[model samples]
Target: MMRVGVISDTHLRSYDRDLAKKLAEHFKDVQMILHAGDITELSVLDMLEAPQVIAVLGNMDGFAAAQSLPAKRELKLEGFQIGLIHGYGPPNGLEERVRREFDDVDAIVFGHSHKPTNYLLNGLLYFNPGSAAGGRGHPKTVGMLTLGDSISGEIIEI
Candidate 1:
């Protein structure tokens, strides 16, 4: 299995030293990191030790690079198809959105609600790591996912 550090919504007003240190400790052995978006600054990605980082642009990500990031993406890990998106529709319909946007993926990961969640539907898993940066109205949160032959995940607060 491959361990993935899942982070999202870090809208930094200034450097976050505590967050950096916490990430280093929590994601120490993660093979990669995935940012589901709303990253207002570029430096957030720079602090990660993982060489492979995949990110999407959230509504609040105002940097130049963020504009170019696709609203959605797909990735294959350990023979599992994974999808990433920043959902904006009603939280109740989130499962349907994942099903509609990433029909072929075995799993989907997203952020924007600033609330961690996990669900299984149509033989696929959908995950939201919430606001890893605890930006403004959100509570600080982050999670780690393990990918392999079978799909399962957990949400963590840090």
Candidate 2:
């Protein structure tokens, strides 16, 4: 099985020591890391201890982040296709909006609402790790995905 760590909405302007430490401890066993955006600065990605890091550009990202990352991504792991994106607009229809961004994917990982979501919908797993920076009155959080015979997600508060 392959384990993937998921985070989003860090919204940091520079490196944060406390956030980094929390990330390291939470994601230490994962093989890959996925940042769902609002990262704001590239230094946030440096905190991860995972071997592979995949990220997208959030609406709040800085120039360097926008230049280096895509607005959306599709990746396959352990025979499952996953879509990663920084969702836009309001939070109500966020799922439907992001769901249309890709096809034939087993899971969609996204953030924008700053809310933690982990559930199976129409046979697809939609995961949002909330705001790792704990902005907008939400609790600090992250997520984990275990990929083997099926894709599953768990939201972790940090």
Q: Candidate 1 — worst ten consecutive residues by lDDT sum? A: 130-139
- Alpha carbon lDDT at 41, candidate 2: 89
Determine the C-alpha RMSD for candidate 2 after optimal superposition of all C-alphas: 0.8
User: Which segments of candidate 1 are over 4 A away from where they belong?
Assistant: 135-138
Off by over 4 Å in 2: none
Expressed as tens digits, the lDDT of each residue in 31-147 for candidate 2 is: 999999999989878887888999999999999998999999999899999999999999899999999999999999999999999999889999999989887788999999999
lDDT of 1 by residue, 52-83 (tens): 98888777777574656778899988898999
TM-score of each: 0.89, 0.97
TM-score of 1: 0.89
At residue 111, candidate 2 shows an lDDT of 97
Candidate 1 structure lDDT: 0.80
Per-residue error for 67 in candidate 1, Å, reads 3.6
Specify the highest-TM-score model's number. 2
lDDT of residue 123 for candidate 2: 93
Model 2, residue 106: distance off in Å is 0.2
